[model samples]
Target chain A: MMRGLAVASTLIVVLIALALFMRSKPILALKPLTTLLFSTAWHPSRGEFGFLAFIAGTLWVTLVASFIAIPVCILASIYLSEYADKRLREWIGPFIDILAGIPSVVYGMWGVLVIVPLVKNIIAPLFGGYSAGYSVLAGGLVLAVMISPVIIHISVEVLRTVPSDLKQASLALGATKWETIKFVVMKRAMPGMIAASVLGLSRAFGETIAVMMVVGNVARIPRTVFDPAYPLPALIANNYGEMLSIPLYDSGLLFAALLLLLVVIYFNVVSKMILSGSKWSLYYNG
Target chain B: MDKKNNIHVRRLEENIFKSLMVFSTGAIVLALALILWTVIRKGLPHLSLGMLTQAPKSGYYLGKDGGILNAILGSLYLTGGAALLAILVSLPVVLYLNVYLKKGSPLAYIARFSFDILWGIPSIVYGAFGFTIMLLFGVKSSLLGGMIAVTFLIFPIMSRSMDEVVRMVPGELMDASYALGATKLETAFKVVVRQALPGISTAVLISFGRGIGDAASLIFTAGFTDSLPTSLLAPAATLPLAIFFQFGTPMPEVQGRAYASALTLTLIILVISVAARLLTRKFTKHVV
Candidate 1:
């Protein structure tokens, strides 16, 4: 019975991929892959269905979020694992969990109330630009905050796996604390940190409701961070309900879902490979 | 003099980097505080007992009479059903990984990798997949469909967390059970399950919190309704979607209700987190 259940468990991913592909075959058959992927037009009423703008928007937001999140998370995790005492680390644990636990809709609401205005009136203007507050910057800011906990939690675990004796050896060789961390601990933990960041990127890439709320869903390529953009997840979420009315519109949205699934799977598989191939897993599993 | 100057420069760099790290951590904590404060300050005025008890009345979206009792109950029902379904699948899968499979079994490793990948798949994709299944089966967007979608979303979360705890169960304990003439199945059910109970409960609660708070997976699976669902086939309202719809309205009053809804969701999640922590602490005394 257990063996049967385990086999069934492994089949779910295959089934989901197959199901999505079958459902989206109509649109795939209608248009060449390049036109569907590279064309800029998205007028479903007129039978146009290009996904380039949404893809670009997804990449842009994920990139902006990575810029904001990666440094802060790495620093914070380093501090927690290296500098903070046990009591402080224990206290911070629940805080990170709470941050992760807060519903995405709540984050969206907060973004609308606070971050949007700050970007509109203060940060954007300081840079000699104007924004309505609902822009790629707003979406990226919210997403950065949303994915921080994931990166921090994983990176901290990775840092902790770097044996203390290695650090001691560096210090015993007359290295300063910062130098030991930079040369020894970070060198040891690099693969794990990369894995953590990749995981965070995947999480940010497929976020839907929060980004949808703040991202002022325009389907054009954004020229600047302050411009509105539409992302793949948001596109699927906003249009799936109404797509049944148009020809192959439902297929188009399902195709978007399929694309998201494939990308996320690639990221996860790569991170898994990194984690398993590194010496960190040997230390971690042992 | 040259050695002293070098030491001074190194000290300055260390201090600067340390301060930056501290500031980054502080900024994250401050963002959390600001999010909670914004929700409370805006939602507290509009939150009332009626909002928890009564359904929305006519013109409710226009800032009129009534509350969001339907959504609260609907969220509770949907999460409860999904949690039950997920636990059924997750527990068996987790047990098989820890108890049935060999330590270095390739199948176990593949199963875990798949779960991790599934966990990373966005809720919106699950929503779309659920919609596809519904189309194939001629099932409309209803409570049953929502439960099915959420089950898929949380299965990996529940299974993987439970696996973490169960894998920690010592081999010596299982050996003891076998030496006493117990079968592997008996040992698993009686010994390993008892040891991992605390972690299993925490996993269930955490996944429950996630299912309750998610909006993307339910947007297409559970069609929104003003009234409470009367059957498994009936449409249901959820707190996250309620907040989404209300906040999208043009009126400030409706927008205020959205804040209140957000506050309600946040509080529920907070309670679940605290409960998980406390339960883990309380139940850990029995473990060796």
Candidate 2:
């Protein structure tokens, strides 16, 4: 009973802290929160909060990042989980495991020393100077690669768990191997696939360090993939350590975090419900 | 004979696709290998004990060795202590959550909502929150503050993984243990825990690697320190933070060392993850 009390109290401390920190009155008193986040200027040192340029830039980069990631990862997961031979699967699984473990710092270092120069020197002229050094294209492209392993892992797990009896029954009814996989396995795994994709989306939504190093941190919406922009996490990372005040301090920083927290929680709940709610029907359908 | 002919064609088609699959898989392997090679190329040639034993040294080409030794010790002290603390707290809460909370309860749903939200809040948010708490307590850049940030970052993972390993302990086993006159605690500690130990261990290892590899979260909460971590109450340097610091600075040697340090960190994470997966394989085999 004492142990239970202890656990409950601890949880209450953390949750209540979050609420108190994000209370409505406290939030509104800080800055014109919307104007800060949505403004076109972001010259904090000069007292301009035009973040519209950065806000748009961040979303564009993330969208393109996820766009590049989702398709390749979906294909890779399908191939690895469904089509690869036993020996190949054995090898492929561990390879991806290590890939997932590669730190973001390493990815950032590679982008800085190698990829930035390529964009600035070789790729820029091709894109009409839009591919200028350390652009969003470099950051988003690196992020696409960085997040692929996560997508593959989740999708492959969902695929691997598709009930074998479904495949057998489909095949038993004269369906081709491909047809069985396409109609039955894919159908059965659709919800889990959605869960996996949502998970991937969350990873993309808040990726920072590497994105910061390579994205150029310019406070403007990129006209093309080659232009640079700042993101919420990157913004915090780039300026948080140096920042020291109220109109541009912890509250503003926490507000961005609050935004990330709310969105992430929503998707997480959606995915959990999708998983648990559909598991029964998927079992029956399979 | 006709069956044999069909098998031959099928074999040929399978072989072609197999090659494609192998090539694709190889592509991923090649990417990781290239990253490691780049790190070593950029970092190893300049690596020395100076990078690990002294303060954040800069201007290596000018014979200056900005040492990261303090950061190395600091990262270890902070991440290690925090991991131990998180495990102690989260393991039981997770087990209790699994054993008693009764899935789908409003309380359970709320608990889960918070856990998932914790995962989604980026590392920077954690840093910001930790910074607030620190300012509230008047303890900035201390290892304790870093631990606070890390505990939040890792708690959700530990609990979620625990919930998974526990729930996967086939309900039939629990029923049998109860039928044999075992209490809930007895059944949990003996039968369910033993059965799922492998999975739980893997989960712990995964979180351990995550805690160690994190740089952004710890940076603000625990600013860089120049001396050996004599106490958990002092600021310190971690490998990830050192890499971030070096990346922006103008020292070829420091830059190289940053790569090397990042390489080391990645290697550590990879090893833990591999071990976790291998351990998980045993439990899954049992699970199936």
Candidate 3:
């Protein structure tokens, strides 16, 4: 019974992939896949169907989010695994869980209510000489908050898998805790930490509602952090309801989903490779 | 004396670095508290019994008259159905990974890899996929379509978490069960299932919370209706969508209702997370 179910699970994934490919096949023939990938003019009503703007938007938001999440997450994981006592660890675990469990829509609401105003009133004006707030910066900040918990959780696990004796040996030799962590533990855990960041990037790229609510959803390539941009997932979520009203619009959105799928698959495959190559199956042993 | 000076400098740097990390961890706690505080401060006053039990009437978006009962019930129905489907599909696949196949088999590897990909694929893409399937089947955005999309959304999370739990079960215990002349299927169902029941339950509720709170995945597939759905074929309104719609409206009263709906959704998720944590702790005492 279990074997049959396992095969069925594999089959289900293939079926979804095939269905997505077939749905996007129509647009595939009209334009070269490369053109679809590089063009940014997404005016479905005018039959202009470039997705470059969304791609750029996703990259900008995700990169900014990574900039904020990666360093903070790595430092926190090191502290949680190496420096913190049992009490601090206990206090932080549930907070991480609560952060992870909060819904994206709620985050979107928070973005709309809080982050956008902060950016509009303070950061954008202070940094960019203006205040639209609903720009890539706000979206990136919200995404940073959303994906940090994920990166921290997985990274802490990866760091914990390093043998305790390695650390103890370094300490016994009079090496400081920071030196042991920097020279030994961090080196051993580098691959897993990279995997954690990759996972967080994949998530930030695919986040829809929160990014959508703050990203301003304009189909233009952003020239500054204060400029509005349209990420691919946001494009699909915002236009999907009205897609049938225009010619080839549904197909365009379907192709966008297909594109997002490919990118996400690539990231996940990379992260999985790192996890497996790290030779520490403590987390992925499942 | 120079060595002592170097030691002092490094110690100072270490202390500074440690404080930075502590601040970052504290920031996460602060962020959660701030989110809850904002939602509750704005939402608590508008939360009423009618919001839970009555359907929205005409001019509801204008804050004229009505409640979010349709959305509340619809969310429950959709999540309940999706959770059931996720369990049925996830249990056997997870069992196959741990029980039927040995570690590092190609088929098992593919199953795990594919689920990881699916797990990372955003909920909005699942909405598109569901919309495509609905088009092919000639079905409108309805309860069934929403359930299908959400099942896909939560299936990987359910299976992967459960797989971890099952992996932690001692191999010797399973070997001992087989030594008793139990068939592989019997051993899996009788011994493995019982051993992982608490973890399995936690996975179920986690998936349930995920399905319940998701909005983008349901927007195009489930569609929306002001009235409660009477059948799987009918359109259904969910709490997240309700919040989305209300917030989009220009009226302050309705926007307040949006916050109330958000608080409702947050509280539900909090309950599930707390329950799952408690269940894991309580059941760990009995697990071998």
Whose TM-score is greatest here? 1
- What is the per-residue lDDT of model 1 for residues B211-271, given as tens digits with 9 covering 90 to 100? 9999999999998999977889999999999999999999999898998899999999889
Docking quality band of candidate 3, CAPRI definitions: medium
Point out where model 1 deviates above 4 Å.
Answer: A277-286, B1-5
In candidate 3, stretches whose alpha carbon ends up further than 4 angstroms from where it belongs are A277-286, B1-5
Please, what are the lDDT tens digits per residue for candidate 2 over residues A130-206? 56578888887778777777777777878877888999999898665655766898898888888877777777777
Pick the winner on DockQ between candidates 1 and 2: 1
What TM-score, computed on C-alpha atoms, does each candidate reach?
0.97, 0.85, 0.96
* Candidate 2 chain A TM-score vs. reference chain A: 0.84
lDDT of 1 by residue, A1-286 (tens): 8889888988888888988999899999999999999999999989899999999999999999999999999999999999988999999867886668899999998988898898899988999998988899999999999998888888898998899999999999988888888999999999999999998999999999999999899999998999988999999999866899999999999999999999999999999888985533211100
Worst 10 residues of 3 chain A by lDDT: A277-286
Overall lDDT per candidate, in order of appearance: 0.89, 0.71, 0.86
The model with the greater DockQ, 1 or 3, is 3
DockQ measured for candidate 3: 0.60
The TM-score-based order of candidates, best leading, equals 1, 3, 2
**Number of the predicted model whose lDDT against the real structure is largest:** 1
DockQ-based class of model 1: medium
Residue B121, model 2, lDDT: 58
Clash pairs, candidate 3, are none
What are the per-model DockQ values? 0.60, 0.33, 0.60
